[model samples]
Target: MPKTLDDELHTAGAGASGRRERAASVPRVAWLIGPALVAGVAYLDPGNVASNMTAGAQYGYLLVWVVVLGNVMAWLIQYLSAKLGIVTGRSLPEVLGARITNRWGRRAYWLQAELVAMATDLAEVIGGAVALNLLFGVPLLWGGLITGTVSIALLVLQSRRGPRTFEFVIMGLLAIIAIGFTVGVFIAPPDPGGLLAGLVPRFADTNSVLLAASILGATIMPHAIYAHSALTRDRFATRRGGPGARRDSGDPTRRIAWHGFGISRPADEPAPAPGTSTEVPTGVLVRATRWDVSIAMAIAGTVNLCILLLAAVNLAGVEGTDSLEGAYAALGVALGPVVATLFAVGLLASGLASTSVGAYAGAEIMHGLLHVRVPLILRRLVTLIPALAILWLGFDPTLSLVLSQVVLSFGIPFALVPLVVLTAKVGVLGQWRNHWATTAAGVGASVFLIVLNGVLLWLVFTGA
Candidate 1:
């Protein structure tokens, strides 16, 4: 029989595992630090740039608390998502797909998830177009087309080269993004007193509240939550011995294990004798994942803060800095053309890296939920059309980016609520189930996000 995609992925994962075991002198944790970094790209997407930059330019440092709070919540949320995949050997969508037996009900859920993915692609494509126009004077529509094409190339890299090579490429772009966004903060430092005050968590008014919601929306992305699980599953999950290894006996415990990191045990497996080493390989990878998630989140959080601080120090109260192009022009006037050019370069990198990841997440959503696979070219073209049409219609890119994030914020509960519930359930994760404290934190974060979105709607609708 021909190998399926899953078989290929499992084989690749197992090969990586074999290589890791052979090189025992190196830290195993080092080998396990990649999936979260790929998912972290979603946090630094163009919607994030628009929301954080707008907040800083319009409200100064007043909403810094929002950005910080969102990252903190994101750490917990993403860890839970990855944990679900690690423990169950399945992505959240796949788990849900199997459990929700009703066909129409499954289809309905897929629709909403599909919409969230489309919204993510919209922000990414528009951001790329804006970057191209700023850097090379390309027309927005043409720039958007270029961005989509490049992203298609990236998807090809992921498919043909397997994920490890793709991770290296994305990480390279991540370095460019980090340098591009943060160098300005060092050149023109933010006020110490104002920056400290922004951490106190008080809102100035309805407008500040609106910006806060946008920041939260951008920071804690739904697609990132979905993608992290699948990424980890692809990297870590496999049969006990290897991809096609068979059980020596009828015992189920010997039948299942996460290749490389012996995480999962089949439900029917017997317990080891008391004298045997009680430690499972799951702990090693889980600990490594903590380091992975922490490092990724720290980098994402810092870059995001630098973006806000860059605007607060250089563009606050400056007229016409509300949009990205305006912000680019303002950065040139205040700092220099060098700083402005770097910002555009970073934006371009962000757009290219993130849109590719977003497309991967969308593909996972479809395959996991609907149990169907579409050609990558067709999937890319379908999602690319709405973004290109928006550019052709001449809608303001920055505003569209911000609104797309709000749409993401609304989709958060659907992904998050299920994650918390499943991770808390002993049936789903067995010994690896979430501790009460972790579940409480997840619940609190989900509630906080839900309430903030409600307040945003109320203020907008009531004209407060």
Candidate 2:
């Protein structure tokens, strides 16, 4: 049989495990960083840069709290995603596909999910292309072609180096982004009092509210929601390769660990069922995964915060500076060419890392929803055509980035509702199911997203 997403992830994860064995002196906390970091890349993609920068420039530090709230919500969603994978051993798409029995229903889901994936790829491609244009003065059309090609090359490289190495490369790029923005933040520090005040949460107007929705759309990506589950489940299975690999429930020790972590199987999913068992303690994995997600997301959150702060300090009240390129040039004038160049370089890093992730999510969505597997290069090509078309048609690159985020906001409900519904179910998740508090939070987040989308629509039509 051809390898499924789960199969490939397991193989790659096992390879990572072998490398871990060779470097036995590495600390325990180090092992859990891969999945979370990989998934967290979505939070720092070009769409986020545009949204956060726009927010800061237009509203000063007023919208910082939205970013904070969005990241906190993302932490919860991603943790649930990791738990779902670890316990059920399926990606979100796979689970969605299995539960919806109607053939047409599945196809409809696939169509919308594919559109969401494309919107995701669109942001990554254009974001990277804009970076190249800023750095090298390349034309946007040619820049997009180069971005698509290089991103696929990175994907191919990841396949060759194995999952762990691929993760390290992403982390390396993330470090560049962090350092770049951190420098920007320090060089042009916003008011400490204003920064503290920004965290109190107040929308300046409908436009600010629109930007908040865009930031939310960018922060908690639909693709990352699907990808995290596949990543965590497969990596754990690969690392714990042994007999009874699937029979994880029999280990009373593991069950206690899960309970200790505030996770439990539902009454319906009793341990030691005829065919279910676990290789290692699920609770240990849960605890480790939580730490991994917490650290990775915290880093991501900080980076996003820095973007908004930098923009507020440098770009506020600057006319005709709504786009990334505009912001880059404005920083050059305000700070110097060096700071602007660093900003471009960080944008480049964000573009490359995120586009690669977008490809992975595209593949998982295809496989899970359609039961069809396409080559990664082919999928990259499919997503590239639309981006190239956008550039070819003379659309502004930065405007394209913002508009793509709007489409993503429209798609959020489709992904979030199903996730919340499934993760809250006892039959599906057993003791690993979300508790009452989590379920409430998940529901509230879902409603928040929907309301934001509604406001976006209202703002678009009313021009308010």
Candidate 3:
């Protein structure tokens, strides 16, 4: 017999026994922070640093609204992605692969997703290499190679340590980024009136629209769209009624014992008796997931906002500030070396951690779309080669990062279209399928992105 929703949730919550006892002492919201933080890395990567910095340096706070809009869209999409994993017990790629009955369609999707992954890695590697060049005087080509090597080492570390350990590492790096940017905002605050006005939302011209699109691509990354589901799926070893019906044995890494994630229940709510149907609804879990995504994205959005604000304040009129390195130097001269170093350090941290996350997403994309499991190491190497070639060809690193994000914008439809389709399908999601409001929002966001990409491509070709 198939397990009911209550059966699946109760079985999953069984892992909370010790957690429940401990929760009697502390809070549970803190437990859900890790997976969302991992997902949030997608928004705070080197691509975002490049795009947000460019927006601030070029247009000042005029483009701040774009960053805000991009992050809001990202959080919505990421929430759906995580909920999909939680409800279906499968990642988005795995779901898409199952649904794409035609072999040719799967292959085509796989090709586009691979290209997207490469674009993502290109930005991350360039950011890492640029950071190395800025801080240590390493040459770009050599820095590229070192960046690749260090990324591999981090991947190896993750495999050895398991997912929870890996997540803690990412969270630590995210903290560094948060601290650096917070200090930056203190040093170079944006004009309060102008910053508030930027939130009013009107593009000044065509170039502003293009930059906004790039920022959207950078914030709502395709790889992240693929990876979040996998991350959440891994958080629970079982879906609902399938197998052992027990919580995963994987040691959850949290500072405090997570008693339970019952958003619908009061803090003092008693645990449901074992083997009894708990009145706790699946909606409770869903709400809890959104809370996690909200907290994580809120932090990420703030960081991105700070990046744009810093650039607007310090590098708005500075020549040659288009690149991350130039921005660092300008900040140093305008503020101090410590502020400059913080920016470089934040970039480096973003580069390293997001590269690792990007690699994980690439693996998911390959395995999901193609059903072919390439070794993770081989996948990382495959993506690394293109970044190396870009450096070897002497492309400007900052410009390359910006162009890579633009390429990512072009690839968004492949992921977004399918994501919207699957989440709305009642057959797949059952009670958790998107409500009408969510469906409308998802479709609207998807259409908006597609139209934006269309306009961008037309602009590029016609030189309008």
TM-score of each: 0.87, 0.86, 0.86
- What lDDT does the true structure give each of the candidates? 0.84, 0.79, 0.79
lDDT of 2 by residue, 1-464 (tens): 96542333333334434531121121243554588899999899999999999988999999999899999999988998888777776788888888889999999998988998898888998988899999999998898899898889888987675566678888899898888766888887889999999999788787887788888889889889988887775555432332113434323234221111122233344444332322234655676688889988999999999999998988999987798878998999999999899999989899889999889888889988888889988889988998899988988878778777777777878888888888888777776778899999999999988987887788778988
Ranking by lDDT: 1, 2, 3
Q: What does each candidate score in C-alpha RMSD?
A: 8.1, 9.0, 7.2
Tens digits of per-residue lDDT, candidate 3, 1-464, equal 96644343444455445332112222233544567789788788888888889989999889888888888888889988887876676788998998899999999888988998999999999998998889999988898888888878878877776566788889999998888766878976779998999898877777877788889889888889899888876654332342112222122221111223422122244544443212322444466688889988999999999999999998998999988888998989998999899889888888888999999999998888788898888889888999999989999888888888888887887888888888888777776788888878888888988988888778778887
Candidate 2 minimal-lDDT segment of 10 residues: 255-264
Candidate 1, superposed: residue stretches over 4 Å from native: 1-27, 240-280
Ten-residue segment with the worst summed lDDT in candidate 3?
248-257
Local lDDT at 427 for model 1: 76
Write the residue-wise lDDT of candidate 1 on 35-57 in tens digits: 88999999999999999999999
For all candidates, the clash counts are 0, 12, 1
Q: Please give the distance, in angstroms, between residue 210's alpha carbon in candidate 3 and its true position after superposition.
A: 2.1
Q: Which candidate wins on TM-score? A: 1
C-alpha positional error of residue 54 in candidate 3 after TM-score superposition, expressed in Å: 1.1
